[model samples]
Target: MSAPETATPTIPDYAGDPNAVLNDTNAVWRHGGPPNYSNTRKNWEIAASFKSFLTDWRTVDPNKYTFVMNGGEPQSAEHMLRSNFYSPLNNDFESSHKTFKRMMPTFAWEVLEVYSGPPKVAFKWRHWGVMKNDYVGYNDKKQKVRVKAHGGPIDIQGVTVATVNGALKVEKLETWFDPLSMFKQVSKDNEVFIDEDSA
Candidate 1:
Protein backbone atom coordinates (compact mmCIF):
# COMPACT_ATOMS: atom_id res chain seq x y z
CA MET A 1 0.00 0.00 0.00
CA SER A 2 1.15 3.57 -0.73
CA ALA A 3 1.99 5.74 2.28
CA PRO A 4 0.04 8.97 2.86
CA GLU A 5 1.83 12.22 3.69
CA THR A 6 1.10 13.68 7.13
CA ALA A 7 0.88 17.41 7.68
CA THR A 8 3.11 19.01 10.27
CA PRO A 9 1.51 20.50 13.37
CA THR A 10 1.63 24.29 13.59
CA ILE A 11 2.15 26.52 16.60
CA PRO A 12 -0.55 29.09 17.24
CA ASP A 13 0.51 32.63 16.44
CA TYR A 14 0.74 35.08 19.34
CA ALA A 15 -1.44 38.06 18.54
CA GLY A 16 -0.63 41.73 19.30
CA ASP A 17 2.68 43.22 20.21
CA PRO A 18 4.33 41.05 22.82
CA ASN A 19 5.92 44.04 24.50
CA ALA A 20 2.91 46.38 24.42
CA VAL A 21 -0.19 44.19 24.64
CA LEU A 22 -1.11 45.68 27.99
CA ASN A 23 -1.33 49.12 26.38
CA ASP A 24 -4.37 48.32 24.27
CA THR A 25 -5.78 46.18 27.11
CA ASN A 26 -7.92 48.00 29.61
CA ALA A 27 -7.84 47.88 33.42
CA VAL A 28 -11.37 47.55 34.74
CA TRP A 29 -12.43 49.73 37.68
CA ARG A 30 -15.23 48.70 40.02
CA HIS A 31 -15.41 51.38 42.74
CA GLY A 32 -13.92 52.68 45.96
CA GLY A 33 -10.33 53.76 46.52
CA PRO A 34 -8.53 55.94 49.02
CA PRO A 35 -9.90 59.43 49.45
CA ASN A 36 -8.16 62.32 47.61
CA TYR A 37 -7.11 59.93 44.86
CA SER A 38 -8.55 60.29 41.37
CA ASN A 39 -8.98 56.90 39.72
CA THR A 40 -8.70 58.14 36.18
CA ARG A 41 -7.70 56.35 32.99
CA LYS A 42 -4.29 57.95 33.15
CA ASN A 43 -3.65 56.29 36.48
CA TRP A 44 -4.92 52.96 35.21
CA GLU A 45 -2.74 53.13 32.11
CA ILE A 46 0.25 53.94 34.23
CA ALA A 47 -0.33 50.91 36.42
CA ALA A 48 -1.05 48.69 33.44
CA SER A 49 2.08 49.68 31.55
CA PHE A 50 4.33 49.83 34.57
CA LYS A 51 5.90 46.45 33.90
CA SER A 52 6.49 47.23 30.26
CA PHE A 53 8.02 50.56 31.10
CA LEU A 54 10.36 48.83 33.48
CA THR A 55 11.40 46.41 30.80
CA ASP A 56 12.85 49.26 28.71
CA TRP A 57 14.24 50.96 31.75
CA ARG A 58 17.25 52.71 30.29
CA THR A 59 14.99 55.73 30.01
CA VAL A 60 13.84 55.27 33.60
CA ASP A 61 15.60 57.37 36.15
CA PRO A 62 17.28 55.02 38.57
CA ASN A 63 16.86 57.42 41.48
CA LYS A 64 13.11 57.59 40.85
CA TYR A 65 11.92 54.02 40.28
CA THR A 66 11.72 51.00 42.58
CA PHE A 67 9.97 47.63 42.63
CA VAL A 68 9.19 44.99 45.21
CA MET A 69 7.09 41.86 45.66
CA ASN A 70 4.66 41.09 48.47
CA GLY A 71 6.02 43.27 51.32
CA GLY A 72 9.67 42.74 50.65
CA GLU A 73 12.29 45.42 49.94
CA PRO A 74 12.83 47.07 46.57
CA GLN A 75 14.60 45.23 43.77
CA SER A 76 15.62 45.73 40.16
CA ALA A 77 14.11 44.00 37.12
CA GLU A 78 17.02 41.58 37.01
CA HIS A 79 16.35 40.53 40.59
CA MET A 80 12.63 40.13 39.97
CA LEU A 81 13.04 38.08 36.77
CA ARG A 82 15.62 35.77 38.28
CA SER A 83 13.63 35.22 41.47
CA ASN A 84 10.13 34.99 40.06
CA PHE A 85 10.53 33.45 36.59
CA TYR A 86 13.29 30.95 37.24
CA SER A 87 16.16 30.23 39.61
CA PRO A 88 17.14 33.35 41.54
CA LEU A 89 20.83 32.53 41.28
CA ASN A 90 20.77 30.51 38.06
CA ASN A 91 19.07 32.44 35.25
CA ASP A 92 20.08 36.01 34.60
CA PHE A 93 17.97 38.65 32.86
CA GLU A 94 18.51 37.56 29.23
CA SER A 95 18.16 33.82 29.76
CA SER A 96 15.14 34.03 32.08
CA HIS A 97 13.00 36.24 29.82
CA LYS A 98 14.13 34.46 26.67
CA THR A 99 13.44 31.02 28.13
CA PHE A 100 9.93 31.91 29.25
CA LYS A 101 9.16 33.81 26.03
CA ARG A 102 10.10 30.81 23.92
CA MET A 103 8.23 28.34 26.12
CA MET A 104 5.11 30.48 26.33
CA PRO A 105 5.12 32.52 23.15
CA THR A 106 1.57 33.69 23.58
CA PHE A 107 1.90 35.09 27.07
CA ALA A 108 -0.62 37.85 27.67
CA TRP A 109 -1.35 40.17 30.56
CA GLU A 110 -4.33 42.22 31.73
CA VAL A 111 -5.45 44.16 34.75
CA LEU A 112 -8.64 42.77 36.23
CA GLU A 113 -9.42 45.88 38.27
CA VAL A 114 -7.98 49.00 39.79
CA TYR A 115 -8.59 49.49 43.48
CA SER A 116 -6.76 52.74 44.01
CA GLY A 117 -4.90 55.60 42.26
CA PRO A 118 -1.48 57.05 41.66
CA PRO A 119 1.13 58.15 44.22
CA LYS A 120 -0.11 54.84 45.64
CA VAL A 121 -2.06 52.73 43.19
CA ALA A 122 -3.51 49.33 44.02
CA PHE A 123 -4.83 46.93 41.40
CA LYS A 124 -5.31 43.30 40.50
CA TRP A 125 -3.64 41.88 37.40
CA ARG A 126 -3.32 38.62 35.48
CA HIS A 127 -0.45 36.92 33.64
CA TRP A 128 -1.35 34.06 31.34
CA GLY A 129 0.06 32.05 28.46
CA VAL A 130 -0.30 28.80 26.56
CA MET A 131 2.37 26.11 26.73
CA LYS A 132 3.26 26.23 23.04
CA ASN A 133 6.48 24.48 23.88
CA ASP A 134 8.05 22.68 26.83
CA TYR A 135 8.26 24.55 30.12
CA VAL A 136 11.92 24.63 31.10
CA GLY A 137 13.42 26.14 34.21
CA TYR A 138 16.73 26.18 36.00
CA ASN A 139 16.92 25.46 39.67
CA ASP A 140 19.17 27.35 42.09
CA LYS A 141 21.81 24.69 41.47
CA LYS A 142 21.66 25.44 37.68
CA GLN A 143 20.16 22.01 36.96
CA LYS A 144 17.57 21.87 34.21
CA VAL A 145 13.94 21.39 35.25
CA ARG A 146 11.47 20.78 32.47
CA VAL A 147 7.84 19.88 31.83
CA LYS A 148 6.47 18.63 28.54
CA ALA A 149 4.19 20.85 26.51
CA HIS A 150 0.52 20.43 27.38
CA GLY A 151 -0.86 23.12 25.01
CA GLY A 152 -2.95 24.41 27.92
CA PRO A 153 -3.41 27.78 29.53
CA ILE A 154 -1.16 28.73 32.42
CA ASP A 155 -2.32 31.65 34.56
CA ILE A 156 -1.55 33.62 37.68
CA GLN A 157 -3.20 36.64 39.25
CA GLY A 158 -2.18 39.10 41.92
CA VAL A 159 -2.66 42.49 43.53
CA THR A 160 -0.17 45.28 42.86
CA VAL A 161 0.35 48.36 45.02
CA ALA A 162 2.69 51.02 43.75
CA THR A 163 3.63 54.62 44.32
CA VAL A 164 4.21 56.91 41.36
CA ASN A 165 5.79 60.31 41.21
CA GLY A 166 4.32 63.37 39.52
CA ALA A 167 6.27 62.35 36.44
CA LEU A 168 4.33 59.06 36.41
CA LYS A 169 7.33 57.06 37.47
CA VAL A 170 6.67 54.02 39.66
CA GLU A 171 8.81 54.86 42.66
CA LYS A 172 7.90 51.88 44.77
CA LEU A 173 5.91 48.90 43.54
CA GLU A 174 4.85 45.78 45.42
CA THR A 175 3.02 42.75 44.08
CA TRP A 176 1.44 39.87 45.99
CA PHE A 177 0.51 36.51 44.46
CA ASP A 178 0.53 32.77 45.06
CA PRO A 179 3.56 31.76 42.99
CA LEU A 180 3.35 28.08 43.99
CA SER A 181 -0.03 27.77 42.29
CA MET A 182 1.51 28.89 39.01
CA PHE A 183 4.46 26.55 39.48
CA LYS A 184 2.22 23.54 40.08
CA GLN A 185 0.70 23.83 36.60
CA VAL A 186 4.06 23.24 34.87
CA SER A 187 4.94 20.24 37.05
CA LYS A 188 5.36 16.83 35.41
CA ASP A 189 2.42 15.51 37.43
CA ASN A 190 0.46 18.41 38.83
CA GLU A 191 -1.77 16.16 40.96
CA VAL A 192 1.11 14.38 42.63
CA PHE A 193 0.71 15.31 46.29
CA ILE A 194 3.28 14.45 48.91
CA ASP A 195 2.25 12.64 52.06
CA GLU A 196 2.63 15.23 54.80
CA ASP A 197 2.68 12.70 57.67
CA SER A 198 5.64 10.86 56.18
CA ALA A 199 7.80 13.94 56.25
Candidate 2:
Protein backbone atom coordinates (compact mmCIF):
# COMPACT_ATOMS: atom_id res chain seq x y z
CA MET A 1 0.00 0.00 0.00
CA SER A 2 1.26 3.45 -0.86
CA ALA A 3 1.11 6.33 1.60
CA PRO A 4 -1.21 9.23 0.87
CA GLU A 5 0.43 12.47 -0.20
CA THR A 6 -0.23 15.47 2.01
CA ALA A 7 -0.93 18.87 0.56
CA THR A 8 1.64 21.61 1.03
CA PRO A 9 0.57 24.67 2.97
CA THR A 10 0.59 27.86 0.94
CA ILE A 11 1.80 31.19 2.27
CA PRO A 12 -1.08 33.67 2.68
CA ASP A 13 -1.48 36.54 0.21
CA TYR A 14 -2.52 39.82 1.89
CA ALA A 15 -2.82 42.47 -0.88
CA GLY A 16 -0.29 44.72 0.90
CA ASP A 17 -2.52 45.45 3.91
CA PRO A 18 -0.57 44.11 6.89
CA ASN A 19 -3.70 43.67 9.02
CA ALA A 20 -5.58 41.72 6.38
CA VAL A 21 -2.88 39.05 6.36
CA LEU A 22 -4.06 37.60 9.69
CA ASN A 23 -7.36 36.55 8.15
CA ASP A 24 -5.59 33.98 5.97
CA THR A 25 -6.57 30.51 7.14
CA ASN A 26 -3.48 28.98 5.59
CA ALA A 27 -1.30 31.07 7.87
CA VAL A 28 -2.94 30.01 11.15
CA TRP A 29 -2.68 26.60 12.85
CA ARG A 30 -4.01 25.47 16.22
CA HIS A 31 -2.57 22.51 18.08
CA GLY A 32 -5.80 20.55 18.74
CA GLY A 33 -7.73 22.64 16.27
CA PRO A 34 -9.83 25.60 17.46
CA PRO A 35 -10.99 25.39 21.04
CA ASN A 36 -14.70 25.49 21.88
CA TYR A 37 -15.22 27.94 24.67
CA SER A 38 -18.72 28.81 25.86
CA ASN A 39 -19.61 32.31 24.69
CA THR A 40 -16.39 33.54 23.09
CA ARG A 41 -15.81 30.55 20.84
CA LYS A 42 -19.34 30.69 19.55
CA ASN A 43 -19.01 34.40 18.85
CA TRP A 44 -16.78 34.33 15.79
CA GLU A 45 -17.07 38.07 15.31
CA ILE A 46 -15.42 38.74 18.66
CA ALA A 47 -12.47 36.66 17.61
CA ALA A 48 -12.28 38.51 14.34
CA SER A 49 -12.42 41.86 16.11
CA PHE A 50 -9.73 40.79 18.56
CA LYS A 51 -7.52 39.68 15.71
CA SER A 52 -8.10 42.89 13.82
CA PHE A 53 -7.04 44.96 16.80
CA LEU A 54 -3.91 42.88 17.05
CA THR A 55 -2.88 43.09 13.38
CA ASP A 56 -3.67 46.78 13.17
CA TRP A 57 -3.62 48.99 16.25
CA ARG A 58 -4.88 51.85 14.14
CA THR A 59 -8.15 49.97 13.74
CA VAL A 60 -9.11 51.79 16.96
CA ASP A 61 -8.77 55.52 17.34
CA PRO A 62 -5.84 56.03 19.70
CA ASN A 63 -6.63 59.69 20.31
CA LYS A 64 -10.03 58.78 21.69
CA TYR A 65 -8.73 56.13 24.10
CA THR A 66 -5.62 54.46 25.48
CA PHE A 67 -4.62 50.78 25.40
CA VAL A 68 -2.63 48.94 28.06
CA MET A 69 -0.24 45.99 27.59
CA ASN A 70 1.31 43.81 30.31
CA GLY A 71 3.73 40.96 29.62
CA GLY A 72 3.38 38.95 32.86
CA GLU A 73 5.73 41.26 34.66
CA PRO A 74 5.31 42.86 38.06
CA GLN A 75 2.35 45.23 38.16
CA SER A 76 3.22 48.89 37.96
CA ALA A 77 0.92 51.87 37.60
CA GLU A 78 3.34 53.78 35.40
CA HIS A 79 3.95 53.19 31.69
CA MET A 80 7.58 53.24 30.63
CA LEU A 81 9.51 52.26 27.49
CA ARG A 82 12.84 50.54 28.02
CA SER A 83 15.33 48.91 25.67
CA ASN A 84 14.71 45.55 27.31
CA PHE A 85 11.44 43.95 28.49
CA TYR A 86 8.16 43.55 26.58
CA SER A 87 6.17 45.06 29.46
CA PRO A 88 6.22 48.69 28.50
CA LEU A 89 4.78 51.33 30.82
CA ASN A 90 1.01 51.76 30.51
CA ASN A 91 -0.22 54.54 28.12
CA ASP A 92 2.75 54.25 25.76
CA PHE A 93 0.70 52.54 23.08
CA GLU A 94 2.17 54.39 20.11
CA SER A 95 5.80 53.65 20.92
CA SER A 96 4.98 50.08 21.83
CA HIS A 97 3.07 49.52 18.60
CA LYS A 98 5.90 51.01 16.57
CA THR A 99 8.38 48.77 18.34
CA PHE A 100 6.23 45.70 17.81
CA LYS A 101 5.79 46.44 14.08
CA ARG A 102 9.49 47.05 13.60
CA MET A 103 10.36 43.77 15.33
CA MET A 104 7.83 41.54 13.60
CA PRO A 105 7.40 42.92 10.10
CA THR A 106 5.79 39.73 8.78
CA PHE A 107 3.71 37.85 11.29
CA ALA A 108 0.46 35.99 12.01
CA TRP A 109 -1.44 34.84 15.07
CA GLU A 110 -3.06 31.41 15.39
CA VAL A 111 -5.80 31.66 18.00
CA LEU A 112 -6.02 28.54 20.14
CA GLU A 113 -8.34 29.51 22.97
CA VAL A 114 -10.57 32.41 23.96
CA TYR A 115 -12.52 33.50 27.03
CA SER A 116 -15.02 36.35 26.88
CA GLY A 117 -16.22 38.12 29.98
CA PRO A 118 -17.67 41.45 31.06
CA PRO A 119 -15.29 44.30 30.17
CA LYS A 120 -12.47 41.86 29.37
CA VAL A 121 -11.72 39.07 26.92
CA ALA A 122 -8.68 36.84 26.82
CA PHE A 123 -7.22 34.50 24.23
CA LYS A 124 -4.32 32.11 23.87
CA TRP A 125 -2.63 32.08 20.47
CA ARG A 126 0.52 31.20 18.59
CA HIS A 127 2.53 33.98 17.00
CA TRP A 128 4.32 32.81 13.88
CA GLY A 129 6.54 34.84 11.60
CA VAL A 130 9.81 35.39 9.73
CA MET A 131 12.23 38.18 10.53
CA LYS A 132 12.57 39.92 7.18
CA ASN A 133 14.14 43.11 8.49
CA ASP A 134 16.91 43.80 10.97
CA TYR A 135 15.35 44.58 14.36
CA VAL A 136 17.43 46.18 17.08
CA GLY A 137 19.64 43.56 18.74
CA TYR A 138 19.00 40.95 16.06
CA ASN A 139 19.99 43.47 13.41
CA ASP A 140 23.37 44.33 14.85
CA LYS A 141 24.94 41.03 13.78
CA LYS A 142 23.26 40.96 10.38
CA GLN A 143 24.12 44.58 9.64
CA LYS A 144 27.80 43.98 10.47
CA VAL A 145 27.84 41.21 7.85
CA ARG A 146 25.67 43.18 5.43
CA VAL A 147 23.05 40.45 5.45
CA LYS A 148 19.69 41.56 4.10
CA ALA A 149 17.60 39.22 6.20
CA HIS A 150 17.73 36.72 9.08
CA GLY A 151 15.60 34.20 10.98
CA GLY A 152 13.19 31.53 9.78
CA PRO A 153 9.56 30.98 10.79
CA ILE A 154 9.06 31.73 14.50
CA ASP A 155 6.26 29.74 16.13
CA ILE A 156 5.64 30.75 19.73
CA GLN A 157 2.57 30.51 21.95
CA GLY A 158 1.29 33.48 23.97
CA VAL A 159 -1.70 34.67 25.95
CA THR A 160 -3.37 38.05 25.56
CA VAL A 161 -5.75 39.76 28.01
CA ALA A 162 -7.82 42.55 26.51
CA THR A 163 -10.53 44.93 27.54
CA VAL A 164 -13.03 45.72 24.83
CA ASN A 165 -15.61 48.47 25.10
CA GLY A 166 -19.21 48.12 23.90
CA ALA A 167 -18.06 49.64 20.61
CA LEU A 168 -15.86 46.55 20.04
CA LYS A 169 -12.67 48.52 20.33
CA VAL A 170 -9.74 47.12 22.28
CA GLU A 171 -9.20 49.39 25.25
CA LYS A 172 -6.31 47.47 26.77
CA LEU A 173 -4.25 44.36 26.08
CA GLU A 174 -1.81 42.34 28.17
CA THR A 175 0.34 39.60 26.66
CA TRP A 176 2.59 36.89 28.07
CA PHE A 177 5.19 34.86 26.17
CA ASP A 178 8.65 33.37 26.51
CA PRO A 179 11.05 36.03 25.29
CA LEU A 180 14.15 33.89 25.91
CA SER A 181 12.95 31.19 23.55
CA MET A 182 12.03 33.75 20.91
CA PHE A 183 15.42 35.46 21.08
CA LYS A 184 17.21 32.11 21.02
CA GLN A 185 15.43 31.13 17.81
CA VAL A 186 16.21 34.48 16.25
CA SER A 187 19.85 34.13 17.22
CA LYS A 188 20.04 30.66 15.72
CA ASP A 189 18.47 31.70 12.44
CA ASN A 190 20.66 34.82 12.19
CA GLU A 191 23.83 32.75 12.75
CA VAL A 192 24.70 34.77 15.83
CA PHE A 193 25.61 31.79 17.98
CA ILE A 194 27.18 32.09 21.39
CA ASP A 195 30.00 29.76 22.40
CA GLU A 196 28.69 27.82 25.39
CA ASP A 197 32.11 26.23 25.96
CA SER A 198 33.76 29.61 26.38
CA ALA A 199 31.21 30.56 29.04
Candidate 3:
Protein backbone atom coordinates (compact mmCIF):
# COMPACT_ATOMS: atom_id res chain seq x y z
CA MET A 1 0.00 0.00 0.00
CA SER A 2 1.18 3.56 -0.66
CA ALA A 3 2.17 5.61 2.35
CA PRO A 4 -0.69 7.53 3.95
CA GLU A 5 -1.00 11.08 2.60
CA THR A 6 -0.64 13.75 5.25
CA ALA A 7 -2.74 16.88 5.34
CA THR A 8 -1.06 19.97 3.92
CA PRO A 9 -0.40 22.66 6.44
CA THR A 10 -2.36 25.83 5.73
CA ILE A 11 -1.09 29.33 6.33
CA PRO A 12 -3.40 31.92 7.81
CA ASP A 13 -4.03 34.78 5.45
CA TYR A 14 -3.57 38.21 7.04
CA ALA A 15 -5.99 39.65 4.40
CA GLY A 16 -3.66 42.51 3.50
CA ASP A 17 -4.14 43.69 7.05
CA PRO A 18 -2.17 42.17 9.91
CA ASN A 19 -4.42 43.86 12.41
CA ALA A 20 -7.36 41.75 11.33
CA VAL A 21 -5.93 38.71 13.06
CA LEU A 22 -4.38 40.79 15.83
CA ASN A 23 -7.66 42.21 17.08
CA ASP A 24 -8.62 38.88 18.56
CA THR A 25 -7.79 38.15 22.22
CA ASN A 26 -5.75 34.96 21.80
CA ALA A 27 -3.01 36.92 20.05
CA VAL A 28 0.17 37.97 21.85
CA TRP A 29 2.44 40.87 20.95
CA ARG A 30 6.12 41.49 21.74
CA HIS A 31 8.72 43.97 20.59
CA GLY A 32 11.25 42.64 18.08
CA GLY A 33 13.55 45.69 18.01
CA PRO A 34 13.80 49.26 16.76
CA PRO A 35 12.66 49.94 13.22
CA ASN A 36 14.44 51.84 10.43
CA TYR A 37 12.77 54.96 9.04
CA SER A 38 12.38 55.81 5.37
CA ASN A 39 10.51 58.48 3.44
CA THR A 40 9.02 56.16 0.86
CA ARG A 41 5.28 56.09 0.16
CA LYS A 42 5.07 52.30 0.40
CA ASN A 43 6.53 52.45 3.88
CA TRP A 44 4.05 55.13 4.85
CA GLU A 45 1.09 53.01 3.73
CA ILE A 46 2.29 50.07 5.77
CA ALA A 47 2.66 52.24 8.84
CA ALA A 48 -0.78 53.75 8.41
CA SER A 49 -2.43 50.37 8.08
CA PHE A 50 -0.68 49.05 11.15
CA LYS A 51 -1.63 52.12 13.15
CA SER A 52 -5.27 51.57 12.24
CA PHE A 53 -5.05 48.06 13.59
CA LEU A 54 -3.73 49.35 16.92
CA THR A 55 -6.55 51.84 17.46
CA ASP A 56 -8.89 49.16 18.72
CA TRP A 57 -8.10 47.81 22.18
CA ARG A 58 -11.34 46.15 23.21
CA THR A 59 -10.12 42.74 22.04
CA VAL A 60 -6.91 42.65 24.04
CA ASP A 61 -6.90 40.81 27.35
CA PRO A 62 -5.34 42.85 30.10
CA ASN A 63 -4.06 39.87 32.07
CA LYS A 64 -2.32 38.31 29.08
CA TYR A 65 -1.04 41.43 27.32
CA THR A 66 2.19 43.31 28.06
CA PHE A 67 4.17 46.17 26.48
CA VAL A 68 7.88 46.92 26.91
CA MET A 69 9.87 49.92 25.75
CA ASN A 70 13.61 50.06 25.00
CA GLY A 71 14.15 46.83 26.95
CA GLY A 72 12.91 48.51 30.06
CA GLU A 73 10.25 47.24 32.49
CA PRO A 74 7.31 45.46 30.97
CA GLN A 75 3.99 47.24 31.45
CA SER A 76 0.73 45.38 31.71
CA ALA A 77 -1.91 45.79 29.04
CA GLU A 78 -4.24 47.59 31.43
CA HIS A 79 -1.53 49.98 32.48
CA MET A 80 -0.47 50.70 28.92
CA LEU A 81 -4.05 51.17 27.76
CA ARG A 82 -4.85 53.59 30.54
CA SER A 83 -1.60 55.53 30.70
CA ASN A 84 -0.10 55.50 27.25
CA PHE A 85 -3.15 55.11 25.06
CA TYR A 86 -6.14 56.49 26.89
CA SER A 87 -4.63 59.06 29.20
CA PRO A 88 -2.78 60.83 26.43
CA LEU A 89 -5.97 61.38 24.51
CA ASN A 90 -8.47 62.08 27.29
CA ASN A 91 -6.87 63.30 30.46
CA ASP A 92 -9.50 64.48 32.90
CA PHE A 93 -7.06 66.93 34.38
CA GLU A 94 -6.47 68.72 31.10
CA SER A 95 -9.04 71.35 30.17
CA SER A 96 -8.47 70.88 26.47
CA HIS A 97 -7.92 67.92 24.19
CA LYS A 98 -4.25 67.00 23.98
CA THR A 99 -1.82 64.61 22.27
CA PHE A 100 -3.70 62.11 20.06
CA LYS A 101 -6.19 64.43 18.38
CA ARG A 102 -3.64 67.18 18.05
CA MET A 103 -1.20 64.86 16.33
CA MET A 104 -3.71 62.72 14.43
CA PRO A 105 -3.54 64.55 11.13
CA THR A 106 0.24 64.52 10.91
CA PHE A 107 0.70 61.13 12.53
CA ALA A 108 2.10 58.58 10.14
CA TRP A 109 3.99 55.32 10.30
CA GLU A 110 6.05 53.47 7.75
CA VAL A 111 6.00 49.73 8.07
CA LEU A 112 9.40 48.52 6.96
CA GLU A 113 8.75 44.77 7.29
CA VAL A 114 6.53 42.10 8.72
CA TYR A 115 7.32 38.57 9.86
CA SER A 116 4.70 36.02 10.67
CA GLY A 117 4.13 32.45 11.75
CA PRO A 118 1.31 30.62 13.46
CA PRO A 119 0.43 32.43 16.69
CA LYS A 120 3.10 35.08 16.16
CA VAL A 121 3.50 38.27 14.11
CA ALA A 122 6.03 41.09 14.15
CA PHE A 123 6.01 44.53 12.54
CA LYS A 124 8.99 46.82 12.12
CA TRP A 125 7.90 50.39 11.46
CA ARG A 126 8.75 54.08 11.55
CA HIS A 127 6.37 56.61 13.14
CA TRP A 128 6.05 60.29 12.29
CA GLY A 129 3.88 63.11 13.65
CA VAL A 130 3.95 66.87 13.91
CA MET A 131 3.10 68.82 17.00
CA LYS A 132 0.35 71.30 16.22
CA ASN A 133 0.09 72.58 19.76
CA ASP A 134 1.74 72.26 23.13
CA TYR A 135 2.00 68.64 24.34
CA VAL A 136 1.36 68.66 28.06
CA GLY A 137 2.94 65.96 30.20
CA TYR A 138 5.23 65.28 33.09
CA ASN A 139 8.88 66.26 32.70
CA ASP A 140 11.99 64.43 33.90
CA LYS A 141 11.42 65.96 37.32
CA LYS A 142 7.84 64.60 37.44
CA GLN A 143 6.52 68.11 37.12
CA LYS A 144 3.70 69.02 34.73
CA VAL A 145 4.96 70.80 31.64
CA ARG A 146 3.97 71.63 28.11
CA VAL A 147 6.22 70.53 25.22
CA LYS A 148 5.96 72.35 21.91
CA ALA A 149 6.99 71.12 18.49
CA HIS A 150 6.79 74.49 16.74
CA GLY A 151 4.97 72.80 13.82
CA GLY A 152 7.90 70.49 13.00
CA PRO A 153 7.39 66.80 12.46
CA ILE A 154 8.82 64.27 14.90
CA ASP A 155 9.96 60.93 13.54
CA ILE A 156 11.02 57.74 15.28
CA GLN A 157 11.40 54.04 14.54
CA GLY A 158 10.00 51.14 16.52
CA VAL A 159 8.85 47.52 16.41
CA THR A 160 5.78 45.65 17.60
CA VAL A 161 5.57 41.94 18.40
CA ALA A 162 2.26 40.06 18.48
CA THR A 163 1.13 36.55 19.31
CA VAL A 164 -2.14 34.77 18.68
CA ASN A 165 -3.72 31.57 19.86
CA GLY A 166 -5.75 29.02 17.95
CA ALA A 167 -8.81 31.18 18.56
CA LEU A 168 -7.04 34.03 16.74
CA LYS A 169 -7.40 36.46 19.65
CA VAL A 170 -4.57 38.81 20.61
CA GLU A 171 -3.11 37.84 23.97
CA LYS A 172 -0.08 40.09 24.24
CA LEU A 173 1.56 43.09 22.56
CA GLU A 174 4.92 44.77 23.18
CA THR A 175 6.27 47.90 21.50
CA TRP A 176 9.72 49.48 21.51
CA PHE A 177 10.86 53.06 20.82
CA ASP A 178 13.60 55.54 21.70
CA PRO A 179 12.37 57.93 24.39
CA LEU A 180 15.40 60.20 24.18
CA SER A 181 15.02 60.73 20.45
CA MET A 182 11.34 61.58 20.83
CA PHE A 183 12.01 64.06 23.61
CA LYS A 184 14.96 65.60 21.80
CA GLN A 185 12.90 66.25 18.69
CA VAL A 186 10.13 67.98 20.63
CA SER A 187 12.52 70.02 22.72
CA LYS A 188 14.59 71.02 19.70
CA ASP A 189 11.67 72.55 17.84
CA ASN A 190 9.91 74.37 20.68
CA GLU A 191 10.45 75.46 24.20
CA VAL A 192 9.35 73.31 27.13
CA PHE A 193 7.99 75.33 30.01
CA ILE A 194 6.81 74.19 33.41
CA ASP A 195 3.03 74.07 33.68
CA GLU A 196 2.57 73.17 37.30
CA ASP A 197 3.93 71.00 40.09
CA SER A 198 3.09 67.33 39.96
CA ALA A 199 0.15 66.76 42.24
Residue-level error in angstroms, candidate 1, position 109 = 0.8
Per-prediction CA RMSD (Å): 19.5, 15.7, 9.0
- Candidate 3 local lDDT, residue 190: 44
What value of lDDT does candidate 1 attain over all alpha carbons?
0.57
TM-score (all chains, Cα) for each model: 0.63, 0.43, 0.56
Off by over 4 Å in 1: 1-60, 81-85, 188-199
- Give the worst 10-residue stretch by lDDT in candidate 3: 77-86
Q: Model 1, range 1-199, lDDT digits (tens) per residue?
A: 9999998844211122232323324423222211122222233333333334443332234576666776777776533433222576776655666677688876666789999876688999888888788766676545566667778888989998878665445567788987676666666365322323321
Report the C-alpha lDDT of model 2 over 45-145, residue by residue, as the tens digit: 22333332433333332444343445544332223433222334321444444444566664565679987663577889886788666443212122212
lDDT (C-alpha, whole model) for all candidates: 0.57, 0.46, 0.52
* Leading candidate by lDDT: 1
Off by over 4 Å in 3: 1-58, 61-63, 78-97, 140-142, 196-199
**Decreasing TM-score order of the candidates:** 1, 3, 2
Candidate no. 1 TM-score: 0.63
Q: Give the winner by TM-score.
A: 1
Quote the positional error of residue 112 for candidate 2 in Å.
Answer: 1.7
Candidate 1 vs 3: which has more TM-score: 1
- How high a TM-score does candidate 3 get? 0.56
